[model samples]
Structures are given as structure tokens and as C-alpha cells.
Target chain A: MGIQLDFPAVLERWPSFLGGAALTLELAALATMFGALLGTLAAVGRGTHNALIAGACKVYVETIRNTPLLVQIFLVYFGLASLGLKFSAFTVAVAALTINVGAYTAEIMRAGFEAIPRGQIEAAEGLALSRVQIYWHIILLPAVERVYPALTSQFVLLMLASSVCSQISAEELTAIANYIQSDTYRAFETYIIVAVLYVILSLVMRAGFWGLGLVLFPRRRRLGTPL
Target chain B: MQQNTSSEPIVSLRDVQKSFGPLKVLDGVSFAVDRGEVLAIIGRSGSGKSTALRCIDRFEKVDGGEIMVCGHRVDRPDVDLRALRQDVGIVFQSYNLFPHLTIEQNITLAPCAVKKMATGQAKELARKVLAQVGLEEKLHAYPEQLSGGQQQRAAIARSLAMQPKVMLFDEVTSALDPELTGEVLKVIEQLAADGMTMVMVTHEMGFAKSIADRIVFMHRGKVHESGPASILTSPTTPELRQFVGTGNLKS
Candidate 1:
């Protein structure tokens, strides 16, 4: 017999679901901003002439990217606790997520940086632009523009992956769903709603990023194509 | 007329030598471009003409010998490259314009960043240089939007915005269509007439013969033959004979 479905129980908890989604967005937004900054610095560090700095950035990207996010979350949670330091679950989750996504963003940004034509850098050098000036104008900005799509996708994935923070009692969307499913004994119905909420969030994020791309990269917009 | 009142060469390479791994690109080549004089370097593809031009800008470090540009000893270990570049402008075969910026922005970037010019002044400078290159109307356009000839002109304008004492052109028109080449050459001719001290490695014998006050012919990484523009018409070496007498060597 096909079992009876009870979406009404989940729908009645719309406030809780919405609150959870809001918290998820908060975590994702913070992570995306800080992670982008950290990743860009790491990408630049990787390309620098100093061996020690490049090696350290390499280790960070490799270790973070290779390990699971769940393990990272637990490490940040309990590892801090064991060190006689304590932070809120929300803080721990954001720290974990930022650390995780920064690695991926770094790799994506590095590929973008490498894809820039050598002639571009040479031209800038020939013009007597300082090293930092060259990196900022000729290398970084155009590279970010060329790989905007890749960066957007990685950030969206990071948002979805924020669900794993539930294990650390982050109370994000997934944690709330876990609470509701167990409380109401409506696991199937609760999960379906959460899945739909995730889909909606991802779409909202993509649209927001697409609009940002239009503003930040006017050249690409004017050309109506990737540079 | 004495173009240079000081009678000192503005750009000089003294027995400069450079090698790329197993290949000797610039082998003890020496040349000097006096202030307000146009010097053309002509040679075949493998003759190291481009490398010699590059060394003057320190783009290629010479293995031996010295390079002096605008009073900066480029061969010195502590050579101030930025200072040297500020006084010397270079254009290349490829326009190498920053595609992300407008023509105006591309021309103003170095001046504003390096010279600390205010935005209003930089914009005015951009306008002046763009006018010099006959591209004042295309200032707001991105590089990709312009034709190859227009892009090269814009590149020249970008260099001119620095108001350099000396200009280096490394086959600046070699990549252009025959029809497009004339416009770029015309811009160079104007720069020469304006008394810009220039050292250009060129393949356009006709353009070189007309614009160059002196010509340095390179072969096997050495100055095989060099003299006034008249040398292009009457040569003294067999290489020069076979090059200009029978057929233009493109070398």
C-alpha cells in the first residue's frame, strides 16, 4: 500500500523553515565574502616568489580540499573546545565553511590567473607598473571576470554544503529539518520541504551572482560574452 | 641642423651579448641612437634584431657589455628599471592593449599609477595622446571593439602618453594587414617628424628607408652593415648586395 503523506505538518512549521533558511543564508553570505578574500590572498601567495609562503598556501589548499567538511566542522568544534577555547555553534560553522570553501576558490582563482595571456603582463611591465599594481589591474580583476561563473558555482555549492554544519548543532536549515522530522515524526515530508528550500536558495544565489557579475564586469556585459 | 644640442646618444648598446640557453640571440651587437634621430634595425627572423631592441629596454638582459638609455645604466645590477622605462617608450608587433579597459583608461593607467597624475589631468593627457595617434574619437572604445590598425594606433598613443624621451618600436607593424600597415607607419612617421628619438626593429624596408636617418643591418647577431639611409640603395657587403640590390632581404 502506498503510505499516507502528511505535508500539512511541515507546512505548519513554515516559520521554523524560513528561519532556518535565513540562518543558512547568513552563514553562506559570511563564508562567501570572507572565503573570497582569503582565497584570493592564498592564490596570490601561491604565485609569489617566496618559497615558504607558496609552500604554506599549497599545504593549506591541499589539506583543506582533500579532507571532508564534516571532519573539518568537528575539528573546529571540539578542537577549539579541547583547547580551552569556546565559540558559538554559528561561529564554529562559519569558520569551518569559510576554511573549506577558501581552498576551492583559491584553486579556481589560480586557474583564472594562469589563463591570462603573458603578453598582458609583459605590457604592464613594459609600462612600468609596480608589482602590486600589475597584480591588481592586469592580473587579478580580469582573471576574476573570466572565471566568474566558476566562482559562482563553487559558492553555491558551498551554500548547499553548509547543511553539514547541522552535526555541530549549527541550527541552519538542515539542523532545523532534523529537529522537525524527529519532533513531528514527519521525516519524509520535512526533508522534501527542506530539499525544495535548498533548490530555491540556490536559484536565488545564482540570480544574485549573475546580477553582481553584470555590475562588476561591465566589459564582459558590453561584449555580451566572456573575455 | 644639430637635432641634439648636447651631442650625446640617448640610447646606446655597447658590445651587448645575450643568449637563450643553447642559442646566441644577441652576439656583441653595438648601436647608438642620438637624440631626435630615427634608427632602424633590419635583419631576418633569426638575426637577433628584435633581441637587440629588447636589450635596450632591459627586457632581455645582456650576458656581456653595457646598455644605457636616458642616462640609466640598464646593465648595472642596481639599474632603476622603472626610471629607465619612464623615459623610454616601446611598442610591439601585437598591440597588447588591456582588453578590459577602454582606450582612454589603457592610455591613462600607467601615467596615473606611475606618475601620480590626477584623474582630470590624466584624462587630458589621454586626449592629447589619442589625438597624436589620430584616435581621439575611439578613446571610449574597448580594444576588442577596434580594428587591428586602430588598436595599434591606440597602443602607440598609450606609449606616447608617458611623454618619453626615447621610443622603441619592435616591428610594431609586422602583424598588420598590408592595408592596415600604412596607418601605423604614418603614426610613426609623425612621431619621427616630431623629433622623437626612436630605435625601431623593422621589416618594412620602404618605411624604414623613408623614416630612418640611420640603418643598422644585423646578421648572425652582429651589425653586419650600418650607415645612412643611402646604404639601402648602395650597399658595400655581399649580404647587403644580395639583400638590397637583387631583392630586399627582409633580413
Candidate 2:
């Protein structure tokens, strides 16, 4: 007889698969929020006139972007443990993901910031707005509006990339697949199911980002115009 | 060329000089705008007209000399630039309306955040100012949704919401189409009739002759000729006469 597939055996552990999917989403959400904040700050830092601050931000962004995310996770996990800073694998996973996504976000935001016209800043100054007011009103808000589509797409990619967290035994979807496949002796079916779950998760994240963009920038929706 | 004796001048620039590397944009420029007076600055491109206006708001820092807006010395190292800005409202050639905000939000942002007015009060004030600019119907429209003239008016309303003591206009109508330019000019004319203190940088001689309390002709970063609008019609200097007589026609 030819080799037979044991698909039912994998389906029997549907609860475990579902739990893994949920954990993956949770990990992605936590990382995305913190990464966005980190990225915005880094973008601002890169744009600042201060030589030291701008240089440090540039170096940080380049270093994170050029290296592999897998290495970063391993470095964060083992490096922290070596220093006796023992954080949970989940916490380390989130940290590593945040660091990785933040660099990409910073570059996207910087491009957005650069797109703002010099005339606009001069106009705001002419109005006698305070520095914080200028930043929020003329600089940051409009820059975000201009690059919002790019930023949201990056976040969705970050969610998909969170699968790499399984390497560190984070108990997310892929990690759960590893556990279940070995237990049930059904490697191919288990991996295939996990891959489908990742695809579903990515779609959900993209939809959520699109919805958030609608709420945050109602003017674009009302006018049916590009920012 | 004497200062107005009726009221205190709200803005004064004395011997202000600004340079960009080798290019000198403003050289020994001096002018004053009295309270409730409309002063129109006219010059060809690169005549330092816009630079002189920017100096009053400290948007372009003066390399030499002093600028006083509402008695706050702008050139002084210790002066609060932001506070000076609060007193001087400026309108630009390109209406720099915040793209992300509705007209109402753009108008109310500074009043609520900078002035710390309550949100209700800010909205009410924005509505009143929008009405003043004939844009009450556009309170919810974003800048991208409006015509150029309407966008400029909203920008003017945004500045007016701050309740600045002096308003500076840098080629405010130059960016609009002829018909659209008329709409923006009409709002400015109303402001002049209402006795708002304003200094305008423009190439519109006809509008300036009709509305300006004083006409200043800038050439090569210095005041070439300055007097009443009647003087602009028959200027004394050859350069001023040539600018008003021919330049106005070509434009």
C-alpha cells in the first residue's frame, strides 16, 4: 500500500491550533503598537538638527535593518540570559520583533516627513504657533497622513514576519505546530495547517489597519481624495 | 515719509538685512505698519519683498537690525520668538492649510492648543472667524476639497482665530487664478475696510492702489519708493516709475 496521510489526526488537535493562532496575533499586536511608537520617535530623532542625536538614530536604524531578524532574536534571547537578565521567551520575542519593525517604520516615516514642503513650516511659524504646536499641527500630523498607507502596510508585514519568533520557542503558531506534529507524528499536515493560519492572520491585520486608517483620517474618506 | 501720528505702529523693521550665502535678499530694509493701517509692499521677483515680510514674524531671521511686532523686539536674543509669532498672523502665497484637518479643525487648532481655550470656545470662535472670511459653509471641508481661493480664505481664518494683533500677507493672492485671486483679494479688502492692521507683499498694483493706506516699493532689498497709493500712480524714482508703469502692465 502507498503511504497514507493522517489528516484527521491533526484535525483532532484543532483547539491547540486555534490557541496557537490566537497567541501569534497577540504577539503581533503587542509588538506592532510598541514598534510604531518606537519608530515615530526614531524618525523624529533622525530628522533633528543635533549632530549627535541624528547620528545615533541613523546608526541604530541601519544596524537593525541590515541584520537578520533571526539573529536578532537569538542575540536578544541568549545575550540577555548571559547577562543574567532572564526574560521569558515570549517577552524576548516581542522585544526582538519591535526592534526589527521599528527600524523599517522609521525609514518610512522619515520619507513622509521629508515630503512636507518648507513653505508649510514657514507658514506655521508665521502664525506664531509654539514649537510643539508646529510639530503636531504642521509636521507630524500631515506627515503621518501622507505616509499612512505605507506605514500600515509595514505593520501588516511585521505581523507576517512574527512567525520567525517560533525559532526562540515562543509558543506562537509555528511553535505550536512543532509541538503538535511531533506528538501526532504528522509533520506535513501540521506545517500546512500552520501556514494557512498565518495567511489568515495577515489578512486580518491588513483589514484592521485599513479600518483604523479610515477612522483616523476621516477627511480623506469624506473628500474621496488622496492625501 | 513720516510715521502715522494717529496710533502706535504695530510692526517696525529697521535696517533689516538677510543673506543666503552669497545672495543678499534684503539689504537695509526699513518700514513700519501702524495699528489698523494697510501697508502694501510691491516688487518684482527677487526684490526682497517676501523676505522683508518674513522678518516681521521672525520666520527668516534677520542677519542685521531689529524687528518689533506689537512692541516685542524680534531681533533681541532674549525675546520669545513664539510669543512674537502669536501677535503676528501671516498668510502665504501657497495657502499652507493642514491637510489632515477639516477647515474647522485647522482654524481651531492653535486657539485650543496654543491659547489653551476650551474646545467649545475654540469651535465657537472658529465658526465666527469662518463667517468673517465667508467660509462658514466650509467648516468641515478639508483643504484638498476646496478651491484655491477658499483654501486661502480658510488659511486666513485659521490665522484670524489666533486673534493676532497684526497680520502679514506674503503674496497671498499671487498663487490663485485670476478669478480665484479676486475672491481672496475681496476678503483682504474687507479686512482693510474693517481696519485690521496688515502688511501685504503683492504684485497686484490695482488692488494695492485701491486698498493700501501706504504703498512701499522695494528694489534690490531696499525701499525704492514709499508714499501713498497716489504716489505709486506717478512715482518719483525712475525704477519705481518703470516698475509701476510697465511691470504692472506685463503682470
Q: Pick the candidate with the highest TM-score.
A: 1
Q: List TM-scores for all candidates, in order.
A: 0.96, 0.95
Candidate 2 local lDDT, A70-95, one digit each (tens): 99999999999999997889999999
Residue-level lDDT for A26 in candidate 2:
92
Per-residue error (Å), model 2, residue A101:
0.6
- What is the C-alpha lDDT profile of model 1 across A1-227, one tens digit per residue? 99889999779999999999999999999999999999999999999999999999999999998899999999999999999988999999999999999999999999999999988887888899989999988888899998888999999999999999999899799999999999999999999999999999999999999999889888888887568
lDDT of each: 0.91, 0.87
lDDT of each residue in B44-156, candidate 2, tens digit only: 89999988988888777788988887878888877887788788888988898888888998888888877889999999998999999899999887888899999999999
Candidate 2 segments whose C-alpha is farther than 4 A from its true place: A1-3, B1-7, B247-251
**Each prediction's DockQ against the real complex:** 0.79, 0.74
Candidate 1: tens digits of C-alpha lDDT, residues B134-174? 99899889999999999999999999888888999999888
**Candidate 1 chain B worst ten-residue window by lDDT:** B242-251
* Poorly placed runs, candidate 1 (over 4 Å): B1-5, B249-251
Specify the poorest-scoring 10-residue window by lDDT in model 2 chain A. Answer: A123-132
